[model samples]
Target: VRLRHALEVRSPTFDTQQFYDLAEKYGCAIVYAEDDEAPEWPKIDLETADFRYARLMSSKPDEPTGMTSAELDAIAKQTQAWAKRGDVFAYFIAGAKVRNPAAAQALIAKLA
Candidate 1:
């Protein structure tokens, strides 16, 4: 399982380490997400789990592929690192939803 959009995880009183420990124990992974609305959310390290789940929510409507080529490349690079360890699941789920397919294709091209 993958947990997403749980803002409480970022709360000061939240026991992050314990949460991770529990997640690991149950074979669950936290979604590593990027959101314009929640920029303060901490980034989840790729090493936290055996598999990765990333939600790319910073796509732009003006960009041809929902995101700039450079952004796609950067994501591909990071994905490569994650793939080296285990399975990688990435989704372009927000911002310019119409261009999500193109963004996904561009990322696949980069990964290729």
Candidate 2:
């Protein structure tokens, strides 16, 4: 039996080689989160696994979609880079519960 696991970390304290080594040992994908609550790890140049995972939990308070065109473009480029080597699973989760789908769609368009 084979099960794939992805870890969503939310603190800067987890940003260490030890944590990455642990994830690699377990064959887990380290999630790159883009929420104010989670420290921005993807902003740094780090790759623990060929496959990548990302969860965008919130947009700016003023932006209902939680992302602007520029933001989505940048994320698309990042995801494209990951996709070049392997697979990338990205989600736009609007913590406010209103624009998640739209944000995701916009990102998808950018990726397309």
Candidate 3:
């Protein structure tokens, strides 16, 4: 956790098992395909990455943050580096860590 914090990463991604474990423990949402339909590697463009991010964000608006190519590349590098560490978690909390129930209700509405 500290390592990710130091690197300014909120999410800690791990293998499938560890990912689920972390999500369960943290009461965060889990996003995955049981059939191992993982996203392809060496993402061709932000659109591709956006698709994955949209899945994580509940497939609402897959907006690209307009980060520079270098900045996005850095993020990809870091994500890959974290993956190399192996045995991590992909727990996600609210973007702002807000405790309001409204966010949950909003998501429920979206999914419904």
- Structural similarity to truth (TM-score) of each candidate: 0.81, 0.81, 0.23
How do the residues 1-112 of candidate 3 rate in per-residue lDDT, one tens digit apiece? 2322111113334434654455445544333221112243122111111112211211112223322335335444544544453422322232323422333343333333
- Cα deviation of 95, candidate 2, in Å: 1.4
Q: After superposition, which runs of candidate 3 have C-alpha atoms over 4 Å from their true positions?
A: 1-65, 87-112
Tell me the spans in candidate 2 whose CA falls farther than 4 Å from its real position.
37-45, 61-64
Q: Which candidate number maximizes lDDT?
A: 1
Give the candidates in order of TM-score, highest first.
Answer: 1, 2, 3
lDDT by residue for model 2 over 1-112, one digit each (tens)? 5667888776677878998899888778888777666545443335677678887775765775568888888888888998987878888775655777778888887777
- What is the per-residue lDDT of model 1 for residues 16-96, given as tens digits with 9 covering 90 to 100? 788777667766667787777677776666355677888888888888899889889999999999899888888998868
Error of 3 at 78 (Å): 0.8
Which candidate model has the greater TM-score, 1 or 3? 1
Residue 106, candidate 1: alpha-carbon lDDT: 97
Given candidate 1, what's the lDDT at residue 71? 88
RMSD of 3: 15.4
